[model samples]
Target: MKQVNALTVAAAVAGALSLAAVTAATPAMAKSVKCYGIAKAGQNDCGNKAGTHSCSGQSKVDYDGGDWKGVASAAACAEMGGQTKPFKGMNPKKKSS
Candidate 1:
């Protein structure tokens, strides 16, 4: 009977800890937003607007305007010169020699 009680307590504690971890992570997840025109070649988080690929990390050019990645916030995305909407060309911020 004592062993059964101890096992029950351990399971309850473990469940509570897992719930606490997920709850603590929720706010950070809520803050994330997709920012286009900022991804480097092969570093995008998901599909591009051009629809040539349907997976992450498939971009063929640096700072492709159609690709995006998750940033901390809209403000952060703008601060980094990224756009909230996808575009049809290379990032305007890219410099040419």
Candidate 2:
């Protein structure tokens, strides 16, 4: 009985130490910014910038200026020729006409 108790306590301590080490070694969440006009068809990360939808995969066209994705860096939006703010996004149907 004594040996069992000692083993249980040792196991508990080891588990707790392992959890603490993992927590300490973990990195923080990467910061992301909203980048518009870059998402492909139905690839928007979240809601539409135009308030047209409240769910993911709601975009109807590719490279929608009104839709955005969470980019890791702010410069990525402009580098991709996209806007960080809402713009007059091109509508595929209307643009084709």
Candidate 3:
């Protein structure tokens, strides 16, 4: 039986680590609850998910209910004058194709 070379094992490990790093850098799909009408301008937890922009810091307006912010607690959402239920923004429009 041929024993694995130490250098080959190290190279494989290093390659795996770098791949994990790249995957980790991308945002994970968190179990975040939707908090509506709470996002400050350019401070949303994620985009409208309507292809507006990438997640986080994408909202262009403040308190845009259409643009929900992710939160861990419903209490915190209410404290921030946000609704647990989602709503339409000031200007409702069709999502782009």
Winning model by TM-score: 1
So what's the TM-score on candidate 3?
0.53
Compared with the true structure, model 1 gives a TM-score of 0.65
lDDT of 2: 0.75
* Backbone steric clashes in candidate 1, count: 0
Identify the leading candidate in terms of lDDT.
1
**In terms of lDDT, which candidate is stronger, 1 or 3?**
1
Across 1-97, the per-residue lDDT of candidate 1 in tens digits comes to 9999999999999999999998997787567798998888898988888898989899888888889988898899999899999988888886422
Question: For model 2, which pairs clash?
Answer: none
Candidate 3 Cα lDDT to native: 0.70
Local accuracy of candidate 2 as per-residue lDDT tens digits, 1-97:
9999999999999999999987874442236778887887788877886788877798887877788887767787677767778677663322321
Error of 1 at 69 (Å): 0.6
Model 3, 1-94: lDDT tens digits are 2355877888899999999997885554365677877777787777774557777888887777667777767887777677777676642332
Off by over 4 Å in 3: 1-29, 49-51, 90-97
